[model samples]
Target: MGIEIIHRPLRTKNALWLPDRNLIVVKERMRSVHTRCSIAHELGHVHYGHVDDRPKHEVQADRFAAENLIDFAEIRDHLGWIGHPQLLAAELGVTHRLLRTYINVHRLAS
Candidate 1:
């Protein structure tokens, strides 16, 4: 992909893709798992050739990141023990939003 990744202080955004430079910029001060997910999300945007950050494009990227970060088998294994979403997301080392996206995809697959 030849995409370069860099960390910066983005006050409002976790990560974003620069199509012109083929670069992915991630927030510098986030947690480790969050940083990884953000990078993955930006990579998703690059993979889909999204030139702009629109809602539809965001959803696509989120789905891509979630699918890549979360394993369905692990989700299933954790479902019985993890009753709260926050805990589940924590256990999975992902954000709640990513966990939700993973759940939506999981439902469709099932």
Candidate 2:
């Protein structure tokens, strides 16, 4: 799949996936972690064959990003000593919100 990645200034959305053109557009000013997550999420959309812009598709994409980006075993092994969410996020190289979402969606006991 010849997927092209383009970075530009997006107004409302962090990223968008054009399935027809196999294109992923990301916001240029986003932080590195955010850009990575957004691209992963868009790739998730592509992998899962999500063409409709629905909430379920977004959730699935989120799940895909979380599962692929963070290692569950690593988090489980390190989470006990990690007191702050920010610290855990930093350790996992993900945003605090993405970490929280992964915890919630996976129902991992914290």
Candidate 3:
């Protein structure tokens, strides 16, 4: 699908996807990494054909974004050992919260 990305002010969420319209609306003021992850997550929703707004779907989308955006093997190779979550997230160009979620979802020790 040719999804069009639109950057604008969103009241509640950082980004949302309209599957019917093939559009993704993102908050313009969001940080670049957040924006990228948000878009990736939304794209996951689209790719997975998720129409229900359920917690499981959201988790799946988040996992998809984390898996695709942050390569675990690459990060591990580069960092060797991750002592701090913030440092690892910063090195991976992702939010600490997202990194934690990724770790939890993948059952990886941080």
Candidate 4:
């Protein structure tokens, strides 16, 4: 009732909160990994009761998403044995690009 994942050509992957209906729409076409990330972001907004009036909310959502989705412990275990980014990305259920970004953002790789 709170959030619904929809597939559409959204200018940006975002959610629309309908106060009247108490519904949230999340883009479904978002990258495999980003789907979870976006879900977490929207949940953060709802959990914190963010007004979504400022662009900063997106950044905050992203931070919440990274914290929720990227399993640092699992990532470390996999990366320790697998040096290939693509392989690790596949195992982590994310794209290579997203994996690289996650790695860089978390400083998981040197």
Cα lDDT listed for each candidate = 0.88, 0.86, 0.83, 0.64
lDDT per residue as tens, model 2, 1-110: 67999999999999999988889999998989999899988988998999866999998888888889989888888877456778888888887767877888877744
1-106 per-residue lDDT for model 1 (tens digits): 8999999999889998999998998999899989989998998999899999999999999999998999888888887645588888888889888988988876
Tens digit of per-residue lDDT, candidate 3, span 1-110: 78899999999988888877889999989899899889988988988998765899988888888888888786667555466778788888887767877888767773
Sorted on lDDT, best first, the list reads: 1, 2, 3, 4
lDDT of 4 by residue, 11-89 (tens): 7645564444545666656665766655666776766677664677765655665566668888877866447987887
lDDT of 3 at 105: 76
Kindly report which residue stretches of model 1 are placed more than 4 angstroms away from their true locations once superposed: 108-110
Task: Report the Cα lDDT for residue 80, model 4.
Answer: 69
lDDT of 4 at 27: 68
Model 1, 22: alpha-carbon shift in Å? Answer: 0.8
Please list the residue runs of candidate 4 whose C-alpha ends up more than 4 Å from where it truly belongs after superposition: 1-14, 28-31, 80-89, 94-110
TM-scores vs. true structure, each candidate:
0.92, 0.89, 0.88, 0.60
Best by the TM-score measure? 1
lDDT for model 1 comes to: 0.88
Compared with the true structure, the alpha-carbon lDDT of candidate 3 equals 0.83
Reference-based TM-score, model 2: 0.89
